[model samples]
Target chain A: MRMNLKGQKKIINIETSQYPNWKICLINELKNLNSNNVEIDCNDIDLSCTDILELISIADQYNCKIISFCSRSIKTIVSSQSLGYKSQFIIKKPSDNTLKMNEKNITFSKSHFHQGTLRSGEYLDSPGDLLILGDVNPGAKVSAEGNIIIWGRLLGIAHAGSKGNSQARISALHLRPVQLRIAKKVARGPKEKPQLGIAEQARIDSDEIIISPLDAT
Target chain B: MATDTRVILICSGKGGVGKTTLTANLGISLARQGLSTAVLDADFGLRNLDLLLGLENRIVYTAQEVLEEECRLDQALVKHKKESNLSLLPAGNPRMLDWLKPDDMKRIVDMLKEQFDYVLIDCPAGVEDGFKNAMAASQEAIVVTNPEVSAVRDADRVIGLLNTNAIKPVQLVLNRVRPRMMANQEMLSIADVTDILALPLLGLVLEDEQVIVSTNRGEPLTLNSVNSPAAKCYLNIAKRLQGEDIPLINPAEESSGFGAKFRRLMQTKIF
Candidate 1:
């Protein structure tokens, strides 16, 4: 099977027999990317957790890309490996250890901090959602590649979607930060202390930083 | 007798919060009080201690050279001319970040402890690898902060990190404080900073332009006996660091009208 490139939009063939359950979602995302010329070549290739590395190697050699995976399959792979499952191992090519592909892109939906306080001069960087168990003191900073959820009082600087994802949000139990950066935009506090009670989430809605109650939805 | 050496790390999370200035002046102050002192510049990226101490040209061998095996440890230590008892271990080239490792830092501090009465390490801003390496061998930590909200916040973070690393008795040095700002509620007071950090206050330095001039001239402020309030404050802080029970002086009240009025009255009566 082959795919044709139309302008900037590249069309690639997606084999569905190996992942029948996620065929529709994959097709929809591809369509959203403005890919029209897709050829379906259903081959009986069993891509399991153990074969992920080999699959990556093959993809690299063939110039193929796999953007998303079935959520259930990912959970199974992560859980099995975490539970000490032994499976087929594929040796990774030693290029740059920092640029290796990772299977689980876990989105942190919620987080909670319990006791410890983040002091000044400390930095917390997370890729998914974050929840601090304690207070974020001044001079301390927390940067999340996704949504930031602070369970305790936040008095430091918190940056959400540091990778420039504007859809990212930040929720905190007590929100009082020196500066809050979401995506490319930044909002500073210290003007007035926010009323504390329910958790509050801050997000950009049409280029404005809006802080609403957590229960707002 | 081989007394156990003490490595005191002077660190602040915020830049321009007087970490290097405190290091140089405090080293001189300690020496004046009869404690053999050595100031180590751990800010590898921006080596300013030599310039702060006016010993930039005197630095022949730096810590980088020592770490790289280009020079011996004793050869890298630069003794002061004004203060014979105080010495400085200047930082090497600005690009020598990876030269000092944790073990190497421990060995360096250990060696300094054996020779100097006090080893004060001036840590660079940020909680990066350099800060960790500096704190790794220090026996105690000194967090310097201004009375401003941002400085206090950073100091809090540094103190928390020190606690996490199990470095005990972390003291606070409040520098460049405008007492009037605190009085007007424009800035965080020394009490507020201490409360937030929950650390013992080492000393408080007032905002003085003379400090800048002294630093430019490569002299420790404490060496200026010409009625510089900042220098006097540093002297008192040095005494306090040596475990002296010196009373904490309030710069605002001390600099206010009472002494000035008395002196004026005496002059008028004599004339």
Candidate 2:
């Protein structure tokens, strides 16, 4: 179908036939079709879960956008939403050929950000990487399943890679922590005062937790 | 201290920072100034406010009795032996520690506030259930800390909690300060403690051997001796708390060193 309203846009519409081996034919046809916008019409097709998932993967592989999935079947509607495309996969009215698309990016970050100081007996735990914008005072703790980055003084306990990721690191502008841990290894602060104006990082080195200047690399 | 009846929790983040001692002595000193004061032993299982006030034997009923309505609030109050205006609502039963809710403490404190001018709650050591239970009813806070890194660190933490709970401008009572150590720069001074904790100076008490001796005798030192350096410290603290213009007392070597020089050179308060 030609989107005549936009001179450069085109829509490749796929209508299923009442044949037992229609999916194979559909895949073969979609393999060679080169269009940015595609519509899958499931008006009378028996769309299964596996077929819907494979269609999505195939569309992504060919760099073809599934602009809309027109389906009157209950199974297709439920399975499309269950596959995490609730708003994208919807029935297209025959009377209206206009397609609604939300091209907003979906981003998932593995790190969490926190602001302000964590005082004594306070805690902040993150399931992934954690970034703290303030100091972690004595008796306070911060734990994460990944790396921990503190922009301020760290005078408390910090546990990185809590889920047993030894490669996780803990970096602080001031790394004078009461205790530092990466995975299973733990290291207490030295008896002497930590040197000021030097940023430090703590990580597991050969099954031991080591603290060194960040510039040490 | 603010004239209106206020429930103030005497707490420290770390243990053994003399929270109970301050509560006992301050309660006595406040009573001596003609303010009707009620000292609540909020340290549920390990109650010591009664023993410190020398009213342990005199306590006929505990907080549990008043909470459960088994006894009247007046029935649970153990009046101080000498101070007519002072009384203690003791932490009655250790077994009831699990059952004592924060609301129960509030109800009890509310009942006492109607009768007393100041309700001083002796909070537990850690910021746990007992501490929350006590602080739930407090309108103000008095953080007690010693002149050391660990105590000051914990007090800073407690001040943070008080701030989070909307208990503003907490008063600090610096306890067990060795003037000689502070003079030698070996210990934290009153300025150093207040700077770190970011609180107003309520008072600074010296590390007197008499404090330990009086605790053993089951007596509030401010009432028993009244002339010991610690006792005089509490009296002066009470005066300052009442909005009086009293200078900070130099409990250290007044006859000889820089403390004396500073006292003479600057008539201004040290705290």
Candidate 3:
């Protein structure tokens, strides 16, 4: 957690994923401040209306007035807004995943399989390799610590080797994704459309992410 | 007749994409087919389903009063002036937004399910509390979207939410389609939209001027203007909802049809 002090207003950005114990962590942080207006950045944490109310009551005990709320989660913003709090919804950049990877450990022993289309704003994350039987529509995302494979089209974002496995590859029947990521490298999707009926694969080649047709020889 | 009632939620994540219009027209069309239908306006905050159905001035009590035990359910339901089988139950006043919960929505829907064969809930825009409340009472959904990227994107998001909530058989309706623009490759084609959304095409509404006129006059086009292109589409949708086999209208053929070609030739001022 980072706290910035500026003229009776403190911006508390809870950057850690404390999961179930986030309230306790937030309360401990709030104890340090004395009668200051606070702005919270609840990045990617989904908070409900009752949870927001609990946050307000906790802040009341700390003499900290939460002036505004900002989150990358639509649910959090909606809940905070419903409680009559000034809230802002922050949109995450498409390829902004490097910072998030530092906290998660890579696991490549298991393979996860999903059977349906992943629509916009939906996310699928696997600890190991990820395989999907249906299309990944635009604005959807799938990430894995190992290889990623799609039996159908991949029109959205896919991140392979999310925890810095440089050898992990992403392959699909149609590889026209909005963005592709392999370990630490990120590349925009190919500008031109792929030839019909040809499956493609993307992987790191000479430190650059490159796309090549999956040769089924 | 089907024994179990069908509670369908008509929702579009974006505003002005014709959720209320579809609900009103579909209600009338179903009622015309001798089935009792009730349209629940879940968008009480910006209530306009009553206005579209031309029952705005006739609403005495709303679902809010029924839930509060201030009025009977039948008293709150306003029967259509022309369509005797069609009824509209306005949700509540704008101030009732704060206290309205998903349970209240379910209670109202449960009560309506007992009296009507079909209950169409006109959901509000945005995937917030209002949308959730409307969604809670629905078993199936019809996601309405325009032939635009933003509208399709929002519909895709809403579809994802519906799937997570276990709403089955979610269908798509591509609204406000201009055949000329679609045929000329100027707008997103039917294939392009269906490819992304990946839902069964329920029906397509051709862009028609009569829709605006009907809305202003508080009469759904399907109620009277059978010749209107959009009205035919709405009737087809209602029939399809009743499990009728109707082939979807082809926008390519519509744009290049003989009548359209003749109209184009006449507008050239060559005569």
For model 3, how does the per-residue alpha-carbon lDDT over B1-271 read when each residue is reduced to its tens digit?
4469999999989999999999999999999999999999999999999999999899999999999999999999999999999999989897767778999999999999889999999999999999999999999999999999999999999999999999989999999999999988899999999999989999999887778888999999989954677899999999999999999999888788798677546534432
Each prediction's DockQ against the real complex: 0.45, 0.38, 0.62
Docking quality of model 3: it rates as: medium
lDDT of 3 by residue, A81-183 (tens): 9999999988875444735553343333367999999999999999899999999999999999999999999999999999999999999999999999999
Task: Evaluate residue B12 in candidate 3 and report its C-alpha lDDT on the 0 to 100 scale.
Answer: 88
DockQ sort, best first = 3, 1, 2
Give per-residue CA lDDT, model 1, range A145-197, as digits (tens).
78888888787899999999899998888887888899999898646767768
Worst 10 residues of 3 chain A by lDDT: A100-109
Candidate 1 local lDDT, B78-171, one digit each (tens): 9888898888996556866677787888878877878878899999998888899899888898889998777876777678889988998888
In DockQ terms, which candidate is top?
3
- For residues B150-251, write the lDDT of model 2, one tens digit per residue: 898888788778878887558988888777678788887777676556678888887767788779888888986544667878887878878897877664
Q: Could you tell me the TM-score of candidate 2?
A: 0.65
Q: At residue B18, what lDDT does model 2 achieve?
A: 95
Model 1, C-alpha of A113: deviation from truth (Å): 6.5
Choose 1 or 3, whichever is better by TM-score: 3
- Worst lDDT 10-window in candidate 2 chain B: B262-271
TM-scores, all models, native as reference: 0.59, 0.65, 0.75
* True lDDT of residue B98, candidate 1: 75
Interface RMSD of each: 1.9, 1.8, 0.5
